[model samples]
Target chain A: SQQGEEDPQALSIQEGENATMNCSYKTSINNLQWYRQNSGRGLVHLILIRSNEREKHSGRLRVTLDTSKKSSSLLITASRAADTASYFCASGNKAAGNKLTFGGGTRVLVKP
Target chain B: GAGVSQSPSNKVTEKGKDVELRCDPISGHTALYWYRQSLGQGLEFLIYFQGNSAPDKSGLPSDRFSAERTGGSVSTLTIQRTQQEDSAVYLCASSLVASGSLNTGELFFGEGSRLTVL
Candidate 1:
C-alpha cells in the first residue's frame, strides 16, 4: 500500500500566484521529503522535514508538517513557469528500510 | 559525478522476453532502491538494499521481478517473461543512510530507464 497521497491531482495558476499541495500518510513516518520532476525526467530533491520538525523553508518553497493530523503541505510562493512540474511527497518509515513510499503526485502548471 | 546513474535510458522488448536495468549509486552510499512508474501514475516501490543487511523485497510485484546489488554499489533489476503490464519507467535511487537519522533519507534518483514490453 502507498503511504502518501497527495491532493489536487492537478493545479494551474498564474506565474506569480502561490500554489499549495497537500499530502496525507497512513503510518507514522520518520521523515517526509518533497521532490520535483519534469515530464519524463528523474526526480529532483527539494526539501526534507523530519518528524521532529514542524516547518522548513528553502528559497521560495515552504513545507509544513503536522504529525497530529498525519498530513503535510508544500507551498510554493511566487511560482514561476520553471516551477511547472510534478510534485511528489515521499514518506519514510523506520521499518520500511529507508525506502520512500511516494504519493500519486500533484502536477502544477504555471502559466506565464 | 555525485548522482545515481541508470543505463539504457530507453528499452523496448517483445513480451515474454527478459530485460535488465542497471543502476550505479553515488560513491560511498550504502542504500539503494528500485521503483516502477506507469504512465500518469505514482511510483511503486520494488526493493531496497542497505549495506550488508538483508534486502527488503517485500514490494516486488511478483516472483518474476528480482534485483541484486553488487559490492554494495551497483545494482540491477531483472524481469523475466515480461508482460505488457510491466512496461513502465524503472527508477533507481540511493541514499546516504538507511535510517532517516542522518541525511534525512533524501534519495538521489537516476534518470529512469523506460521499458516498453510489447
Candidate 2:
C-alpha cells in the first residue's frame, strides 16, 4: 500500500513561476523525502526533511514538513522547463520497518 | 558498477510465460528495493532486502511473484504465468544504509526494466 497521497495530481505553470504540491500520509513518519522522475524512467533524489525539521531548502527546491498534520509540501521556485517532471513524496516510518513508501505523485509541467 | 544496474531494459512475453528481471545494486550497499509502476501511476512496493536477513515480501501482490538476492549482491525478480495486467516498469533501488532512519533513506534507482505481457 502507498503511505503518502499527493494533492493536485497535475499542475501546469509558465516558466519563472512557482509550483507547489502537497503530500499527506497516514502513519507517523520518521522522515520524508522528495524525488523527481523524468521520462518515466529512473527517479533522482531531490531533498529530504526529517520529522524534527519544519522546513528545508536545496537550490530552488523548498520542502516543509508538519508531522502533527501528517503532511508535507514541496515548492519549486523560478521553475524552469527542465523542472517539468513527476514529483513524488516518500515517507519512512518505523511501522514500515526499513523501507520508504511512496505516494501517487504530482505531475508538473513547466511551459516555456 | 558505480550505480544500480538492471538488465533487459525491455522485455515482452506472452501470457502464461515466465520471466526474470535482474538488478545489480551499487557495491557494498546493504539495502535493495523493488517497485512496480504502471503507466503514469504511483510506485507499488514489491519487495525489500536488507543484508543477510530475510527479505520483506509483504508487498508481493501474488504467489506468482517472487524474488531472491544472492551473495548479498545481485537480485532477481521472477514472475510466473504472466498476465497482461502485470505489464509495468519494474524499478530497482539501493540505499547506502537501512531506511526508516534519519540521513539514510535516500535511494539511488536504476533505469528500470520495462516488461510487457501480451
Write model 1 residue lDDT over B1-118, tens digit each, in one string.
Answer: 5789999999999999999999999999889999999998899989999999999999999999999999998999999999999999999998888644535578899999999988
Pairs clashing within candidate 2? none
Q: Looking at candidate 1, what is the lDDT of residue B116?
A: 98
lDDT of 2 by residue, B1-118 (tens): 9999998899999999999999999999999999999999988999999888899999999999999999999999999999999999999999988778776679999999999998
Q: Per-residue lDDT of A1-112 in model 2, one digit per residue for the tens?
A: 4589999899999999999999999998889999999986799999989989999999999999998899999999999999999999999886778688999999999999
> lDDT tens string, model 1, A10-35?
99999999999999999988999999
Candidate 2 chain B superposition, TM-score: 0.97
What is the number of residue pairs that collide in model 1?
0
Model 1, DockQ value? Answer: 0.69
Residue A103 in candidate 2, Cα distance off native in Å? 0.5
Docking class of 2: high
Root-mean-square deviation per candidate: 1.1, 0.9
Interface RMSD of 2: 1.0
